[model samples]
Target: MDLLANLVLGFEAALTLQNLGYATLGVVLGTAIGVLPGLGPVPTIAMLLPLTYALPPESAVIMLAGIFYGSQYGGSTTSILVNIPGESSSVVTCLDGHKMARNGQAGLALATAALSSFFAGCVATVLLAAFAPTLASVAFKFGPAEYFSLMVLGLLGAVALAHGSVLHAICMILFGILLGLVGTDITSGGQRFTMGFSELFDGIEFVALAMGLFGLAEVISNAGRQDDRQLVTKKLSGLWPSRADLRRMTAPAVRGTALGSLLGLLPGGGATLSSFAAYALEKKVSKRPRDFGTGVLEGVAAPEAANNAAAQTSFIPMLTLGMPSNAVMALMIGALMLHNIQPGPQVITNNPQLFWGLVASMWIGNVILVVLNLPMIFVWVKMLSIPYRYLFPSIILISCVGVFSVTNDVFGVFLMAAFGAIGYILLRLDCEVAPMLLGFVLGQSLEAYFRRAMLISDGSLWVFVERPLSAAMLILAATIVMTFFIPTLTRKRTEVFREAE
Candidate 1:
């Protein structure tokens, strides 16, 4: 009953004409960017963040939230139509979605992706609303030691789930932490790694880093690739799926929604991880697993559902505990801080309107996405025909302008360019950037908490281990780190013996 009352209040706030207008604009832009190859939500949101300064806090947040999830709705379009994933989460979709398009079932693939995403979004919103307050209550019980331990656990989990070698991921994370420390120490009021640069006193600009790493780096890398034009189907046969396709997709979508909702609650788990896990789960459970890569409707439906659901639910930790699960959520924290509104348990009680309005707006945003995506499929397809040579310059210009506008300084532009080169090099080395981003975002908080915990315990190193909750989290973190290395050690030993023989 209380939930119903709160939701009623939320609807009243979100249904206003001005708020609805912002939601519409956000979803439209989100879809457009999501349909463009190599333009993921992190870069899109970072690029548009400067524009949000002109709007009210609630409206700004609502619009940004729409873009974050709406991209999930739009990403599958490129995957199915062009065999290119517009977002990382859509990579798995390309495997079966493109195959379906090649087999002349493009319309069916698009329909399944959109419908499953809509269903998952609706379900995930309900889960977010119900679980957030409970999580916030639990978060209130945490102290500095516990928070530090939790962050350690989160970083470890990110490394464990990150793609490629665990050693590389750890190195990337350490690099990010070092970068994060390049500013004035908050407690001591002394510069640590400024290198005599005044701008370094404020720390690295997150917008510059994000745009450089994701936007310019992507543009440069794609430019170096051989330009093979995308092949899109000319005729999208039927707009709606047949009964047989629906029957095949129904169970998978439901299972995917459940899996995604659960995973989204974990630290460092978001849309990309959820989608990968969903596809893996589907393959494990399917009676005829051999058919998974052969353009099965289940393959298209399950991952789309999982990514969308996970995207929505990933907001839970950010809003409730003020802990960002991914780069997108980290940006949301930055947005909230810009408004002078600290996120956490107090956000719900102190700013009910913002909390409820954001929740209610998600539902409205999802509806808008479905309506826009289905009828405007051809428009998005037409966009794909635009050559990369023409698009790349505009993207570069926009990224530079956005970074400059944030700080009103050309120094930010230079920083972006430097990071772009660094990002390009990292890409060539096959290092995963996601874990590094997470580490950078968490580093400040982790440092603050560790110091506070030490202060409280009078410089005792055992303070973290003495607290039950903190001790448990540290134990979990150590276990995760050990799990990754133990198998590698055994494999290396066996390889050495084989070489000797």
Candidate 2:
């Protein structure tokens, strides 16, 4: 009854004329951006980060969150149509989604992705509404020491869960930490690595960094690709799945949702990790394991569902516990802070409207996305028909313009271009940028907590272990790190960490 009443209230909040308009706008823009290859929500959201200042807080957040999941849907469009994944999590979809396209089932692939995302989003929103308060309550018990240890554990899990050479990922994380330290020292008044620039005092702007690294860099890299190869012009067929297809996909979707929802509760690589985990699980459980990579619908559906669910549910820790496990969530934390809403265990009791309204909006938003996208499939496919040379230049121009608009400072444009160059270089080197961004975002908070914990203990380091929860987290972190080094455990860890890149 309580849930029903809150949901009714949520509907009242969601159905408002202003909120509905924002929801529509968000799904539309999110789909448009997601359809474009080489641009993901990170840079786009980061670029638009400044714009949230102008809108009502709930509306802004709803729109931003819409972009996150709507991209999940849009990503598969590119993956199926062009064999180019619009987002990392969609890479697995490319394996089977493209195969389906080749088999002349592009429309089916798009439909599957859209429907799967809509279903998963609905389930995840329910889970988010029901479980958020309980989780927040548990989070309230965490002190600085526990948070610090939890962060450490999160970092370890991220490394263990990420794809690519573990060594390289670690190097990127360390470099990110260094970049994070470039601003000012939290404990001491003296600056650590700022040469003399006043801009360095506040640390590198996350918007600038993210826009440069992910957005601009992707544009540059894509520009260099062979023009003929960049466009996906395949003719599509089969908009509807057969009964057999439905039977195969249903189980994966449900299983993926369960796995994703659970993983979303933990910090770090939640959505991405859950997607990969779901794929591996699907393969393990399938009777026809030999058909794993032959564009099985189950293969496409499972990870797609998992990634979408995890993406939505990742908000659990962020809204409730004030912990952002990834770069995107970190940005959300920034968004909440901008609104003067301190995210923590107390947030649910204090801001029920914000919490429930957001949840309600998510449900409504996903429905809007699915309704809007079905017809837009024709439009998105036509987008592939545009000449690459014409599109690439426009993208670069728009990216530059977007960056400039955000800061209105020429320096920010230069920073974005510089990072774009760096992003391209790292891409060529096969280095993953996600972890670096995550590390950079988390670095400041980790430092603050570390200092606060120390101050409380009068500079004693043992405070991290003196608390039971903190001690347990530290132990978990230690175990995760040690597992990578042990010969017997290395294989399992490597398999778990291996992701599509």
Candidate 3:
């Protein structure tokens, strides 16, 4: 009864003229950006963060959330049509989706991706609404020690899940924590690493950092690259799938949705991981596994559904426990803080309208995406013909303007440029920036929790293990760290034995 009443209230808030308009605009812009290669939700959201300042909190969040998931719907377009993924999550889609396009089943492929995404979005939204409240209840029981332990677990999970060397990920996370500490200490009234600049007093502006690392860095990197994208010029047939096609896709989509929704709830898990995992799972289970790389409909359906489901369910940790599971969610946290609202368990009880309204808006946005994406397929295909030279300049200009608008300070622009260079350097070195961003976002909170726990325990280091929940979290963290080292050790031992032989 209470759930029904709450959902009714959420609909009332979401159905307002202003909220609906913002949601529509967000989805439209999100799709447009998603159609453009090299532009993902991280940079898009970071560039547009200033735009949310003028709106009410509910409206702002609704629009931003729309952009997040709407990109999932649009990402498959470029993957299928151009053999280029518009976002990281769509990379796997290119494996089979573009092959389908090349084989003249482009329309069927697009229809499958869109419909599968819509179904997953609907399921994930329900899972979010059902699970978030229960998770919030569990989070309410956490103390400072437990919270600190949980953060440790989250950070470790990120490192474990990140691609590339675990050592490199750990180094990046440590660097981010160091960067996060470059301001006045919260507990002590003293400055730490300001280097005598007043701008450093407030710590680095997250907008500047994000826009630089993702938005500006992307522009600089792509500026040097030649455009080699081969657009699918083949005429697309009717958009609807045949009954046989639908029958083939239904089970894969369902399984993908279930996998994605579960994965999205994990720390550091989001659309990219879910999509990759789902594709792998499908290939493993399929009787015709050899057909996977040959443009099978199941390959398109499963990954598309998985990424969308993961995109929607990724909000759970951010909303329920105030833990950001990805770079995009970290940005969402910044947005919430900008509105003077602390994101956590209390958000459900204190800001029920905002919480439920955002959930309700997701359903509406998903429906809008299906309607908006199908007919506009031709339009997006046309957009792909636009030259990168013209598009990148506009993107860079907009990012500079947006960063400047944050505080109307030229220093922020300079900061963004500096970080942009650093970001480019990191990119060249093959460092993953996501974990760094997560560590930066969580650094202060982790420090505060650590300090509070120490105070409570009278400086005893045993306090973390003394509590049952905290002990379990720390144990999990240790286990994850060991898992990484164990495999490397085994490989090294085998190599040594071969050399001796």
lDDT of 3 at 43: 87
Of 1 and 2, the candidate ahead on TM-score is: 1
On residues 108-225, what C-alpha lDDT tens digit does candidate 2 reach at each position?
Answer: 7787888778889999999998988778888878888888887778777767666676777787777777888887787677887878877678777666777778777777777766
Per-residue alpha-carbon lDDT of candidate 3 for residues 154-235, written as tens digits (9 for 90 to 100): 9988887776667778988888888888799999879988899998898988888988988888888888767787777558
Residue 246's lDDT within candidate 2 is 80
What lDDT does the true structure give each of the candidates? 0.85, 0.79, 0.89
Candidate 1 regions with alpha-carbon error over 4 angstroms: 488-501
Candidate achieving higher lDDT, 1 or 2: 1
lDDT of 1: 0.85
What does each candidate score in C-alpha RMSD? 4.0, 2.8, 3.8
Once fitted onto the true fold, the runs of candidate 3 whose alpha carbons sit more than 4 angstroms away are 488-501
Across residues 1-501, which tens digit of lDDT does each residue of candidate 1 receive? 989999998888899998899989888888877887767788778777667766788898899999888888888999999888887788889989999999999999999999999999999999988988888889889999998998889888777766666788899888888888889998999998899999889899887887788778888888855545476687887879889888889999998999988887777788887888899899999998999888988899999999999999989988987777887887887778667788777888888888899899999999998888888999988887777788789888988988888889999999999989988899889887777777877788889999999999999989999999999999999988788768776465344323222
Largest lDDT belongs to which candidate?
Answer: 3
For model 1 the local lDDT of residue 152 reads: 89
Which whole-number lDDT from 0 to 100 does residue 191 have in model 1?
A: 97
Evaluated against the true structure, the overall lDDT of model 3 is 0.89
Q: Model 2: runs farther than 4 Å from truth?
A: 1-5, 184-188, 229-238, 242-244, 391-408, 488-499
Clashing pairs in 3: none
Ranking by TM-score: 3, 1, 2
